[model samples]
Target: MDSLLSVCDIKEDVSYIIDLAIKIKAGEIEDMPLEGKTLAMIFQKSSTRTRVSFDVGMYQLGGRAIFLSSNDLQMGRGEPISDTAKVLSRFVDGIMIRAIEHEDVVELAKYSNVPVISGLTNLEHPCQALADMLTIKEHFGSFKGKKICFVGDGNNVCNSLLLIAPLLGMDMSVACPEGYEPDENILKISKNFAKDNNTEITISSDINIALDNVDIVYTDVWVSMGDEAEKAKRLKDLKPYQVNKELMDIANDDAIFMHCLPAVRGQEVSADVIDGPQSVIYDEAENRLHAQKAILYHYLK
Candidate 1:
Protein backbone atom coordinates (compact mmCIF):
# COMPACT_ATOMS: atom_id res chain seq x y z
CA MET A 1 0.00 0.00 0.00
CA ASP A 2 1.26 3.50 -0.85
CA SER A 3 -0.40 5.15 2.11
CA LEU A 4 -3.11 4.40 4.64
CA LEU A 5 -4.91 7.73 4.58
CA SER A 6 -8.21 5.83 4.76
CA VAL A 7 -9.54 2.28 4.93
CA CYS A 8 -10.07 2.29 1.18
CA ASP A 9 -6.30 2.23 0.75
CA ILE A 10 -6.01 -1.06 2.62
CA LYS A 11 -9.23 -2.73 1.43
CA GLU A 12 -7.53 -5.60 -0.35
CA ASP A 13 -4.95 -6.26 2.38
CA VAL A 14 -6.96 -6.09 5.60
CA SER A 15 -6.98 -9.80 6.22
CA TYR A 16 -3.31 -10.13 5.42
CA ILE A 17 -2.44 -7.41 7.94
CA ILE A 18 -4.66 -8.98 10.57
CA ASP A 19 -3.13 -12.40 10.07
CA LEU A 20 0.32 -10.91 10.19
CA ALA A 21 -0.56 -9.16 13.44
CA ILE A 22 -1.69 -12.44 14.96
CA LYS A 23 1.59 -14.03 14.02
CA ILE A 24 3.57 -11.12 15.41
CA LYS A 25 1.63 -11.33 18.66
CA ALA A 26 2.24 -15.07 18.83
CA GLY A 27 6.02 -14.54 18.38
CA GLU A 28 6.00 -16.67 15.23
CA ILE A 29 7.88 -14.00 13.29
CA GLU A 30 11.13 -12.95 14.91
CA ASP A 31 13.04 -11.35 12.10
CA MET A 32 13.31 -7.56 12.08
CA PRO A 33 11.43 -6.67 8.94
CA LEU A 34 12.12 -2.97 9.44
CA GLU A 35 15.77 -3.23 10.44
CA GLY A 36 17.79 -0.04 9.85
CA LYS A 37 14.65 1.85 8.83
CA THR A 38 13.68 5.14 10.47
CA LEU A 39 10.07 6.26 10.77
CA ALA A 40 9.34 9.96 11.30
CA MET A 41 6.14 10.44 13.33
CA ILE A 42 4.72 13.93 13.03
CA PHE A 43 2.17 14.79 15.66
CA GLN A 44 0.02 17.89 15.49
CA LYS A 45 -2.31 16.21 17.97
CA SER A 46 -1.04 14.40 21.01
CA SER A 47 -1.99 10.79 21.79
CA THR A 48 -1.12 7.98 24.17
CA ARG A 49 -1.67 4.84 22.12
CA THR A 50 -0.65 6.23 18.75
CA ARG A 51 2.67 7.63 19.94
CA VAL A 52 3.75 4.76 22.18
CA SER A 53 2.59 1.95 19.90
CA PHE A 54 4.45 3.19 16.84
CA ASP A 55 7.61 3.96 18.83
CA VAL A 56 7.69 0.50 20.42
CA GLY A 57 6.54 -1.19 17.24
CA MET A 58 9.38 0.29 15.23
CA TYR A 59 11.85 -0.57 17.98
CA GLN A 60 10.62 -4.17 18.08
CA LEU A 61 11.16 -4.36 14.35
CA GLY A 62 14.86 -3.45 14.86
CA GLY A 63 14.18 0.03 13.48
CA ARG A 64 13.81 3.42 15.13
CA ALA A 65 11.05 6.01 15.38
CA ILE A 66 11.56 9.75 15.75
CA PHE A 67 8.85 11.66 17.52
CA LEU A 68 8.27 15.18 16.21
CA SER A 69 5.72 17.36 17.91
CA SER A 70 4.20 20.40 16.19
CA ASN A 71 6.73 22.76 17.79
CA ASP A 72 9.63 20.58 16.77
CA LEU A 73 9.26 21.12 13.04
CA GLN A 74 9.09 24.01 10.57
CA MET A 75 5.59 22.90 9.67
CA GLY A 76 4.55 24.44 12.96
CA ARG A 77 6.02 27.74 11.76
CA GLY A 78 3.63 27.83 8.75
CA GLU A 79 5.67 25.73 6.31
CA PRO A 80 3.57 24.15 3.61
CA ILE A 81 2.67 20.48 4.12
CA SER A 82 4.09 19.58 0.72
CA ASP A 83 7.47 21.11 1.60
CA THR A 84 7.48 19.30 4.96
CA ALA A 85 6.52 16.03 3.30
CA LYS A 86 9.27 16.34 0.71
CA VAL A 87 11.92 17.22 3.29
CA LEU A 88 10.84 14.41 5.61
CA SER A 89 10.77 11.92 2.76
CA ARG A 90 14.39 12.64 2.09
CA PHE A 91 15.28 11.88 5.72
CA VAL A 92 12.91 9.13 6.95
CA ASP A 93 11.88 5.81 5.52
CA GLY A 94 8.20 6.52 6.25
CA ILE A 95 5.91 9.14 7.76
CA MET A 96 3.02 8.81 10.22
CA ILE A 97 1.02 11.92 11.00
CA ARG A 98 -1.57 12.59 13.67
CA ALA A 99 -3.20 15.86 12.78
CA ILE A 100 -6.37 17.84 13.39
CA GLU A 101 -7.24 18.15 9.70
CA HIS A 102 -7.53 15.17 7.38
CA GLU A 103 -6.44 17.33 4.49
CA ASP A 104 -3.00 17.91 6.04
CA VAL A 105 -2.25 14.21 6.08
CA VAL A 106 -3.59 13.84 2.55
CA GLU A 107 -1.25 16.58 1.38
CA LEU A 108 1.66 14.95 3.16
CA ALA A 109 0.93 11.62 1.48
CA LYS A 110 0.48 13.23 -1.92
CA TYR A 111 3.91 14.82 -1.75
CA SER A 112 5.93 12.26 0.19
CA ASN A 113 7.86 9.65 -1.72
CA VAL A 114 7.68 7.05 1.05
CA PRO A 115 4.62 5.45 2.57
CA VAL A 116 2.53 7.70 4.81
CA ILE A 117 0.32 6.39 7.59
CA SER A 118 -2.46 8.39 9.09
CA GLY A 119 -1.87 8.03 12.81
CA LEU A 120 -5.16 9.77 13.43
CA THR A 121 -7.24 12.53 11.88
CA ASN A 122 -10.49 14.40 12.40
CA LEU A 123 -12.21 12.36 9.68
CA GLU A 124 -10.79 8.85 10.22
CA HIS A 125 -8.51 6.80 12.45
CA PRO A 126 -7.61 3.92 10.16
CA CYS A 127 -4.88 2.47 12.43
CA GLN A 128 -7.29 2.20 15.36
CA ALA A 129 -9.81 0.51 13.10
CA LEU A 130 -7.17 -2.04 12.10
CA ALA A 131 -6.40 -2.78 15.73
CA ASP A 132 -10.11 -3.02 16.45
CA MET A 133 -10.54 -5.51 13.64
CA LEU A 134 -7.70 -7.58 15.04
CA THR A 135 -9.39 -7.57 18.43
CA ILE A 136 -12.71 -8.64 16.92
CA LYS A 137 -11.10 -11.43 14.92
CA GLU A 138 -9.39 -12.73 18.05
CA HIS A 139 -12.64 -12.79 19.97
CA PHE A 140 -14.91 -14.19 17.25
CA GLY A 141 -12.58 -16.07 14.90
CA SER A 142 -14.11 -14.38 11.83
CA PHE A 143 -15.61 -11.20 10.48
CA LYS A 144 -18.14 -12.68 8.07
CA GLY A 145 -21.81 -12.52 9.09
CA LYS A 146 -20.92 -10.65 12.30
CA LYS A 147 -22.57 -7.45 13.40
CA ILE A 148 -20.95 -4.46 15.16
CA CYS A 149 -22.86 -1.61 16.77
CA PHE A 150 -21.21 1.75 17.50
CA VAL A 151 -22.88 3.94 20.08
CA GLY A 152 -22.31 7.64 20.74
CA ASP A 153 -20.98 10.44 18.52
CA GLY A 154 -20.36 9.21 14.96
CA ASN A 155 -16.78 10.46 14.97
CA ASN A 156 -13.54 9.42 13.30
CA VAL A 157 -13.54 5.93 14.82
CA CYS A 158 -17.07 5.32 13.62
CA ASN A 159 -16.16 6.55 10.16
CA SER A 160 -13.19 4.19 9.95
CA LEU A 161 -15.27 1.25 11.17
CA LEU A 162 -17.97 2.07 8.66
CA LEU A 163 -15.34 2.05 5.94
CA ILE A 164 -13.81 -1.27 7.00
CA ALA A 165 -16.55 -3.55 8.40
CA PRO A 166 -18.52 -3.95 5.19
CA LEU A 167 -15.38 -4.50 3.17
CA LEU A 168 -14.50 -7.40 5.48
CA GLY A 169 -17.98 -8.94 5.18
CA MET A 170 -19.39 -7.66 8.48
CA ASP A 171 -22.47 -5.61 9.19
CA MET A 172 -22.21 -2.31 11.10
CA SER A 173 -24.81 -0.14 12.79
CA VAL A 174 -24.11 3.36 14.03
CA ALA A 175 -26.17 5.10 16.72
CA CYS A 176 -25.70 8.82 17.08
CA PRO A 177 -27.70 11.98 17.54
CA GLU A 178 -29.26 13.66 14.50
CA GLY A 179 -26.56 16.20 13.77
CA TYR A 180 -23.78 13.92 14.94
CA GLU A 181 -24.06 11.21 12.31
CA PRO A 182 -21.10 9.98 10.26
CA ASP A 183 -20.01 11.64 7.04
CA GLU A 184 -22.52 11.12 4.23
CA ASN A 185 -19.84 10.37 1.63
CA ILE A 186 -18.31 7.63 3.81
CA LEU A 187 -21.74 6.15 4.41
CA LYS A 188 -22.41 6.06 0.69
CA ILE A 189 -19.15 4.23 0.01
CA SER A 190 -19.78 1.81 2.86
CA LYS A 191 -23.23 1.03 1.46
CA ASN A 192 -21.70 -0.01 -1.84
CA PHE A 193 -19.18 -2.28 -0.11
CA ALA A 194 -21.94 -3.74 2.04
CA LYS A 195 -24.03 -4.55 -1.01
CA ASP A 196 -21.26 -6.61 -2.53
CA ASN A 197 -20.31 -8.28 0.78
CA ASN A 198 -23.90 -9.19 1.66
CA THR A 199 -23.68 -7.15 4.85
CA GLU A 200 -25.88 -4.28 6.01
CA ILE A 201 -24.99 -0.80 7.21
CA THR A 202 -27.46 1.18 9.28
CA ILE A 203 -27.40 4.61 10.87
CA SER A 204 -30.02 5.79 13.30
CA SER A 205 -30.69 7.75 16.45
CA ASP A 206 -32.11 4.76 18.27
CA ILE A 207 -29.48 2.94 20.29
CA ASN A 208 -31.67 -0.06 20.98
CA ILE A 209 -32.21 -0.81 17.32
CA ALA A 210 -28.54 -0.36 16.57
CA LEU A 211 -27.46 -2.79 19.28
CA ASP A 212 -30.02 -5.44 18.47
CA ASN A 213 -28.38 -8.86 18.20
CA VAL A 214 -25.00 -7.31 17.46
CA ASP A 215 -21.83 -9.31 18.15
CA ILE A 216 -19.76 -6.35 19.33
CA VAL A 217 -20.85 -3.21 21.16
CA TYR A 218 -18.43 -0.34 20.56
CA THR A 219 -18.15 3.23 21.84
CA ASP A 220 -15.68 6.13 21.97
CA VAL A 221 -15.44 9.37 23.87
CA TRP A 222 -18.32 11.65 23.00
CA VAL A 223 -16.14 14.74 22.92
CA SER A 224 -13.04 14.03 20.88
CA MET A 225 -9.98 16.23 20.46
CA GLY A 226 -10.60 19.87 19.40
CA ASP A 227 -14.18 19.73 20.65
CA GLU A 228 -13.79 20.72 24.28
CA ALA A 229 -16.16 23.64 23.83
CA GLU A 230 -18.93 21.26 22.88
CA LYS A 231 -18.33 18.96 25.84
CA ALA A 232 -21.32 20.00 27.94
CA LYS A 233 -23.71 20.05 25.02
CA ARG A 234 -22.35 16.78 23.66
CA LEU A 235 -22.70 15.05 27.02
CA LYS A 236 -26.30 16.17 27.25
CA ASP A 237 -27.09 15.09 23.70
CA LEU A 238 -25.25 11.77 23.96
CA LYS A 239 -26.19 10.88 27.54
CA PRO A 240 -28.95 8.57 26.41
CA TYR A 241 -26.61 6.70 24.10
CA GLN A 242 -23.97 5.72 26.67
CA VAL A 243 -22.97 2.03 26.61
CA ASN A 244 -24.07 0.90 30.04
CA LYS A 245 -25.51 -2.34 31.37
CA GLU A 246 -28.96 -1.42 30.12
CA LEU A 247 -27.61 -0.78 26.64
CA MET A 248 -25.43 -3.89 26.66
CA ASP A 249 -28.45 -5.99 27.56
CA ILE A 250 -29.96 -4.98 24.25
CA ALA A 251 -27.16 -6.72 22.38
CA ASN A 252 -26.54 -10.47 22.11
CA ASP A 253 -25.95 -12.32 25.38
CA ASP A 254 -22.36 -13.07 24.49
CA ALA A 255 -21.60 -9.73 22.91
CA ILE A 256 -18.28 -8.19 23.89
CA PHE A 257 -17.71 -4.56 24.80
CA MET A 258 -14.97 -2.55 23.02
CA HIS A 259 -13.57 0.94 23.35
CA CYS A 260 -10.76 2.53 21.37
CA LEU A 261 -9.09 3.61 24.64
CA PRO A 262 -8.64 6.59 27.02
CA ALA A 263 -12.32 6.10 27.84
CA VAL A 264 -14.11 8.39 30.23
CA ARG A 265 -15.67 5.96 32.73
CA GLY A 266 -19.09 7.60 33.08
CA GLN A 267 -19.37 9.19 29.68
CA GLU A 268 -19.16 7.11 26.53
CA VAL A 269 -19.07 3.86 28.50
CA SER A 270 -19.82 2.97 32.12
CA ALA A 271 -17.19 1.71 34.54
CA ASP A 272 -18.92 -1.64 34.88
CA VAL A 273 -19.07 -2.25 31.17
CA ILE A 274 -15.51 -1.12 30.40
CA ASP A 275 -14.03 -3.05 33.32
CA GLY A 276 -16.55 -5.87 33.19
CA PRO A 277 -15.83 -9.45 32.24
CA GLN A 278 -17.21 -8.99 28.79
CA SER A 279 -14.92 -6.04 28.13
CA VAL A 280 -11.99 -6.56 25.78
CA ILE A 281 -10.63 -3.05 25.98
CA TYR A 282 -7.22 -4.06 27.24
CA ASP A 283 -6.77 -6.72 24.59
CA GLU A 284 -7.91 -4.17 22.06
CA ALA A 285 -5.36 -1.68 23.35
CA GLU A 286 -2.52 -4.18 23.25
CA ASN A 287 -3.38 -5.15 19.71
CA ARG A 288 -2.48 -1.63 18.60
CA LEU A 289 1.17 -2.60 18.86
CA HIS A 290 0.83 -5.79 16.86
CA ALA A 291 -1.55 -4.29 14.33
CA GLN A 292 0.73 -1.31 13.68
CA LYS A 293 3.72 -3.59 13.41
CA ALA A 294 1.95 -5.36 10.59
CA ILE A 295 1.15 -2.05 8.93
CA LEU A 296 4.74 -0.85 9.11
CA TYR A 297 6.00 -4.18 7.87
CA HIS A 298 3.58 -4.01 4.97
CA TYR A 299 4.89 -0.69 3.65
CA LEU A 300 8.44 -0.47 5.00
CA LYS A 301 9.64 -4.06 4.71
Candidate 2:
Protein backbone atom coordinates (compact mmCIF):
# COMPACT_ATOMS: atom_id res chain seq x y z
CA MET A 1 0.00 0.00 0.00
CA ASP A 2 1.16 3.58 -0.72
CA SER A 3 -0.15 4.99 2.54
CA LEU A 4 -2.35 3.85 5.43
CA LEU A 5 -4.68 6.85 5.58
CA SER A 6 -7.65 4.57 6.19
CA VAL A 7 -8.24 0.93 7.02
CA CYS A 8 -9.84 0.41 3.62
CA ASP A 9 -6.48 1.44 2.14
CA ILE A 10 -5.25 -2.05 2.99
CA LYS A 11 -8.29 -3.68 1.34
CA GLU A 12 -7.65 -7.47 1.46
CA ASP A 13 -4.24 -7.11 3.12
CA VAL A 14 -5.73 -6.42 6.54
CA SER A 15 -4.97 -9.96 7.65
CA TYR A 16 -1.40 -9.67 6.52
CA ILE A 17 -0.59 -6.83 8.92
CA ILE A 18 -2.64 -8.30 11.78
CA ASP A 19 -1.15 -11.78 11.55
CA LEU A 20 2.28 -10.30 11.13
CA ALA A 21 1.72 -8.37 14.35
CA ILE A 22 0.70 -11.55 16.19
CA LYS A 23 3.80 -13.34 15.00
CA ILE A 24 6.04 -10.39 15.77
CA LYS A 25 4.59 -10.12 19.23
CA ALA A 26 5.12 -13.83 19.79
CA GLY A 27 8.80 -13.42 18.77
CA GLU A 28 8.22 -15.75 15.86
CA ILE A 29 9.66 -13.22 13.46
CA GLU A 30 13.34 -12.69 14.10
CA ASP A 31 14.36 -10.37 11.34
CA MET A 32 14.68 -6.67 12.06
CA PRO A 33 12.91 -5.71 8.86
CA LEU A 34 13.19 -1.99 9.44
CA GLU A 35 16.85 -1.89 10.39
CA GLY A 36 18.75 1.11 9.05
CA LYS A 37 15.57 2.98 8.23
CA THR A 38 14.08 6.07 9.87
CA LEU A 39 10.52 7.21 10.44
CA ALA A 40 9.45 10.83 10.91
CA MET A 41 6.58 11.13 13.35
CA ILE A 42 4.86 14.52 13.34
CA PHE A 43 2.37 15.44 16.01
CA GLN A 44 -0.17 18.18 15.58
CA LYS A 45 -2.16 16.59 18.38
CA SER A 46 -1.18 15.27 21.78
CA SER A 47 -0.94 11.49 22.18
CA THR A 48 0.04 8.69 24.54
CA ARG A 49 -0.47 5.34 22.84
CA THR A 50 0.13 6.65 19.34
CA ARG A 51 3.37 8.32 20.36
CA VAL A 52 5.08 5.73 22.53
CA SER A 53 4.03 2.77 20.40
CA PHE A 54 5.45 4.09 17.16
CA ASP A 55 8.62 5.45 18.78
CA VAL A 56 9.42 2.23 20.64
CA GLY A 57 8.32 0.13 17.70
CA MET A 58 10.96 1.73 15.52
CA TYR A 59 13.65 1.07 18.11
CA GLN A 60 12.64 -2.58 18.51
CA LEU A 61 12.84 -3.00 14.75
CA GLY A 62 16.37 -1.57 14.74
CA GLY A 63 15.28 1.67 13.08
CA ARG A 64 15.09 5.20 14.42
CA ALA A 65 12.12 7.48 14.99
CA ILE A 66 12.29 11.25 15.19
CA PHE A 67 9.57 12.95 17.17
CA LEU A 68 8.63 16.37 15.80
CA SER A 69 6.04 18.26 17.78
CA SER A 70 4.09 20.70 15.61
CA ASN A 71 5.57 23.61 17.55
CA ASP A 72 9.08 22.57 16.58
CA LEU A 73 8.61 22.68 12.81
CA GLN A 74 8.42 25.54 10.31
CA MET A 75 5.13 24.01 9.22
CA GLY A 76 3.85 25.11 12.60
CA ARG A 77 4.88 28.65 11.62
CA GLY A 78 2.62 28.61 8.54
CA GLU A 79 4.96 26.92 6.06
CA PRO A 80 3.01 25.04 3.39
CA ILE A 81 2.66 21.32 4.09
CA SER A 82 3.77 20.55 0.55
CA ASP A 83 7.16 22.07 1.28
CA THR A 84 7.34 20.29 4.62
CA ALA A 85 6.42 16.93 3.11
CA LYS A 86 8.99 17.27 0.35
CA VAL A 87 11.70 18.19 2.81
CA LEU A 88 10.82 15.41 5.26
CA SER A 89 10.47 12.79 2.56
CA ARG A 90 14.13 13.30 1.70
CA PHE A 91 15.15 12.88 5.35
CA VAL A 92 13.00 9.95 6.53
CA ASP A 93 12.09 6.55 5.17
CA GLY A 94 8.42 7.08 6.08
CA ILE A 95 6.15 9.61 7.78
CA MET A 96 3.61 9.00 10.54
CA ILE A 97 1.49 11.98 11.50
CA ARG A 98 -1.05 12.33 14.26
CA ALA A 99 -2.89 15.28 12.77
CA ILE A 100 -5.80 17.42 13.85
CA GLU A 101 -7.03 17.58 10.28
CA HIS A 102 -7.25 14.57 7.96
CA GLU A 103 -6.73 16.80 4.93
CA ASP A 104 -3.27 17.77 6.16
CA VAL A 105 -2.10 14.18 6.13
CA VAL A 106 -3.62 13.68 2.71
CA GLU A 107 -1.87 16.74 1.38
CA LEU A 108 1.42 15.57 2.85
CA ALA A 109 1.00 12.11 1.33
CA LYS A 110 0.08 13.67 -1.99
CA TYR A 111 3.41 15.48 -2.09
CA SER A 112 5.78 13.03 -0.38
CA ASN A 113 7.62 10.29 -2.23
CA VAL A 114 7.79 8.16 0.94
CA PRO A 115 4.76 6.53 2.49
CA VAL A 116 2.66 8.40 5.05
CA ILE A 117 0.89 6.51 7.83
CA SER A 118 -1.64 8.35 9.91
CA GLY A 119 -1.12 7.90 13.63
CA LEU A 120 -4.49 9.48 14.27
CA THR A 121 -6.72 11.96 12.47
CA ASN A 122 -10.20 13.42 12.84
CA LEU A 123 -11.42 11.12 10.08
CA GLU A 124 -9.84 7.77 11.12
CA HIS A 125 -7.38 5.91 13.31
CA PRO A 126 -6.31 3.09 11.05
CA CYS A 127 -3.36 2.03 13.25
CA GLN A 128 -5.61 1.65 16.28
CA ALA A 129 -8.05 -0.42 14.27
CA LEU A 130 -5.20 -2.73 13.23
CA ALA A 131 -4.16 -3.26 16.84
CA ASP A 132 -7.80 -3.76 17.79
CA MET A 133 -8.11 -6.55 15.24
CA LEU A 134 -4.94 -8.12 16.60
CA THR A 135 -6.36 -8.10 20.11
CA ILE A 136 -9.66 -9.59 18.94
CA LYS A 137 -7.93 -12.34 16.99
CA GLU A 138 -5.63 -13.11 19.92
CA HIS A 139 -8.53 -13.42 22.34
CA PHE A 140 -10.90 -15.33 20.05
CA GLY A 141 -8.42 -17.10 17.74
CA SER A 142 -10.56 -16.19 14.76
CA PHE A 143 -12.71 -13.47 13.30
CA LYS A 144 -15.23 -15.85 11.75
CA GLY A 145 -18.78 -15.25 12.96
CA LYS A 146 -17.70 -12.65 15.51
CA LYS A 147 -19.91 -9.68 16.26
CA ILE A 148 -18.27 -6.48 17.52
CA CYS A 149 -20.34 -3.57 18.70
CA PHE A 150 -19.12 -0.05 19.46
CA VAL A 151 -21.04 2.15 21.89
CA GLY A 152 -21.04 5.95 22.39
CA ASP A 153 -20.11 8.64 19.88
CA GLY A 154 -19.30 7.14 16.50
CA ASN A 155 -16.06 9.03 16.27
CA ASN A 156 -12.79 8.26 14.48
CA VAL A 157 -12.15 4.99 16.31
CA CYS A 158 -15.68 3.82 15.59
CA ASN A 159 -15.32 4.93 11.97
CA SER A 160 -12.11 2.92 11.48
CA LEU A 161 -13.63 -0.09 13.22
CA LEU A 162 -16.66 0.07 10.93
CA LEU A 163 -14.41 -0.04 7.88
CA ILE A 164 -12.44 -3.01 9.20
CA ALA A 165 -14.83 -5.35 11.07
CA PRO A 166 -16.75 -6.36 7.95
CA LEU A 167 -13.60 -6.84 5.90
CA LEU A 168 -12.29 -9.28 8.51
CA GLY A 169 -15.48 -11.38 8.48
CA MET A 170 -16.92 -9.87 11.62
CA ASP A 171 -20.26 -8.15 11.90
CA MET A 172 -20.16 -4.56 13.28
CA SER A 173 -22.75 -2.50 15.10
CA VAL A 174 -22.72 1.02 16.47
CA ALA A 175 -24.93 2.31 19.29
CA CYS A 176 -25.04 6.06 19.53
CA PRO A 177 -27.42 8.98 20.04
CA GLU A 178 -28.79 10.67 16.95
CA GLY A 179 -26.67 13.36 15.23
CA TYR A 180 -23.58 11.59 16.59
CA GLU A 181 -23.30 8.96 13.88
CA PRO A 182 -20.14 7.84 12.08
CA ASP A 183 -19.15 9.86 9.05
CA GLU A 184 -21.81 9.43 6.36
CA ASN A 185 -19.32 8.79 3.56
CA ILE A 186 -17.37 6.29 5.70
CA LEU A 187 -20.60 4.54 6.67
CA LYS A 188 -21.59 4.22 3.02
CA ILE A 189 -18.19 2.83 2.07
CA SER A 190 -18.20 0.38 4.97
CA LYS A 191 -21.65 -0.80 3.95
CA ASN A 192 -20.44 -1.47 0.44
CA PHE A 193 -17.47 -3.46 1.77
CA ALA A 194 -19.82 -5.38 4.04
CA LYS A 195 -22.05 -6.24 1.11
CA ASP A 196 -19.13 -7.65 -0.84
CA ASN A 197 -17.72 -9.48 2.19
CA ASN A 198 -21.08 -10.99 3.16
CA THR A 199 -20.89 -9.46 6.62
CA GLU A 200 -23.23 -7.00 8.34
CA ILE A 201 -23.11 -3.42 9.61
CA THR A 202 -25.78 -2.03 11.90
CA ILE A 203 -26.23 1.42 13.42
CA SER A 204 -28.76 1.89 16.18
CA SER A 205 -29.77 4.41 18.76
CA ASP A 206 -30.86 1.61 21.10
CA ILE A 207 -27.78 0.29 22.94
CA ASN A 208 -29.48 -2.98 23.87
CA ILE A 209 -30.31 -3.91 20.31
CA ALA A 210 -26.80 -3.10 19.12
CA LEU A 211 -25.03 -4.82 22.00
CA ASP A 212 -27.24 -7.91 22.13
CA ASN A 213 -25.27 -11.08 21.37
CA VAL A 214 -22.19 -9.15 20.34
CA ASP A 215 -18.73 -10.61 20.99
CA ILE A 216 -17.14 -7.30 21.94
CA VAL A 217 -18.55 -4.25 23.74
CA TYR A 218 -16.31 -1.36 22.77
CA THR A 219 -16.44 2.32 23.65
CA ASP A 220 -14.46 5.56 23.48
CA VAL A 221 -14.74 8.99 25.03
CA TRP A 222 -17.91 10.85 24.12
CA VAL A 223 -15.87 14.02 23.72
CA SER A 224 -12.74 13.55 21.62
CA MET A 225 -9.69 15.80 21.44
CA GLY A 226 -11.22 18.59 19.30
CA ASP A 227 -14.67 18.22 20.87
CA GLU A 228 -13.77 19.73 24.24
CA ALA A 229 -15.52 22.96 23.29
CA GLU A 230 -18.80 21.06 23.36
CA LYS A 231 -17.93 19.07 26.45
CA ALA A 232 -20.89 19.89 28.70
CA LYS A 233 -23.49 19.29 26.01
CA ARG A 234 -21.78 16.09 24.85
CA LEU A 235 -21.53 14.77 28.40
CA LYS A 236 -25.28 15.28 28.90
CA ASP A 237 -26.26 13.79 25.56
CA LEU A 238 -23.95 10.78 25.81
CA LYS A 239 -24.58 9.98 29.48
CA PRO A 240 -27.12 7.33 28.55
CA TYR A 241 -24.68 5.58 26.23
CA GLN A 242 -21.88 4.97 28.75
CA VAL A 243 -20.54 1.40 28.76
CA ASN A 244 -21.30 0.53 32.33
CA LYS A 245 -21.75 -2.97 33.73
CA GLU A 246 -25.44 -2.76 32.91
CA LEU A 247 -24.77 -1.84 29.30
CA MET A 248 -22.03 -4.44 28.88
CA ASP A 249 -24.31 -7.11 30.29
CA ILE A 250 -26.41 -6.75 27.16
CA ALA A 251 -23.65 -8.40 25.14
CA ASN A 252 -22.78 -12.09 25.08
CA ASP A 253 -21.47 -13.63 28.30
CA ASP A 254 -18.07 -14.04 26.64
CA ALA A 255 -17.98 -10.52 25.29
CA ILE A 256 -14.83 -8.49 25.82
CA PHE A 257 -14.68 -4.81 26.77
CA MET A 258 -12.32 -2.36 25.00
CA HIS A 259 -11.43 1.29 24.94
CA CYS A 260 -8.80 3.33 23.16
CA LEU A 261 -6.64 4.52 26.02
CA PRO A 262 -6.53 7.73 28.09
CA ALA A 263 -10.15 6.92 28.80
CA VAL A 264 -12.23 8.82 31.29
CA ARG A 265 -13.41 6.05 33.62
CA GLY A 266 -16.84 7.40 34.51
CA GLN A 267 -17.64 8.83 31.11
CA GLU A 268 -17.05 6.34 28.32
CA VAL A 269 -16.83 3.27 30.59
CA SER A 270 -17.43 2.45 34.23
CA ALA A 271 -14.57 1.37 36.47
CA ASP A 272 -15.96 -2.12 36.93
CA VAL A 273 -16.43 -2.95 33.25
CA ILE A 274 -13.15 -1.43 32.02
CA ASP A 275 -11.16 -3.09 34.80
CA GLY A 276 -13.19 -6.30 34.73
CA PRO A 277 -11.90 -9.79 33.88
CA GLN A 278 -13.06 -9.59 30.28
CA SER A 279 -11.41 -6.25 29.57
CA VAL A 280 -8.58 -6.66 27.06
CA ILE A 281 -7.70 -3.00 26.81
CA TYR A 282 -4.13 -3.31 28.06
CA ASP A 283 -3.46 -6.11 25.60
CA GLU A 284 -5.14 -4.00 22.95
CA ALA A 285 -2.92 -1.08 23.80
CA GLU A 286 0.31 -3.10 23.71
CA ASN A 287 -0.61 -4.50 20.34
CA ARG A 288 -0.29 -0.99 19.02
CA LEU A 289 3.47 -1.46 19.05
CA HIS A 290 3.43 -4.72 17.14
CA ALA A 291 0.73 -3.62 14.73
CA GLN A 292 2.52 -0.35 14.14
CA LYS A 293 5.73 -2.28 13.61
CA ALA A 294 3.94 -4.28 10.94
CA ILE A 295 2.82 -1.05 9.34
CA LEU A 296 6.28 0.49 9.45
CA TYR A 297 7.70 -2.63 7.89
CA HIS A 298 5.02 -2.69 5.23
CA TYR A 299 5.58 0.88 4.08
CA LEU A 300 9.24 1.41 4.89
CA LYS A 301 10.87 -2.00 4.49
For each of the candidates, the C-alpha root-mean-square deviation to the true structure, in angstroms, is: 0.9, 0.9
Span of ten consecutive residues with least summed lDDT in model 2:
25-34
TM-score of 2: 0.98
Candidate 2 error regions (>4 Å): none
Instruction: Point out where model 1 deviates above 4 Å.
Output: none
All candidates' TM-scores?
0.98, 0.98
* Residue pairs in candidate 2 whose N, alpha carbon or C atoms collide under 3 angstroms: none
Candidate maximizing lDDT:
1
| Prediction 2 global C-alpha lDDT | 0.92
Q: Per-residue alpha-carbon lDDT of model 1 for 1-301, expressed as tens digits?
A: 2999999999999889999999999989878878999999999988999999999999999999999999999999999999999999999999999999999999899999999999999999999999999999999999977999999898999999999999889999998889999999999999999998899999989887888779999999988878999999999999999899999999999999999988999988999999999999999999999999999998898
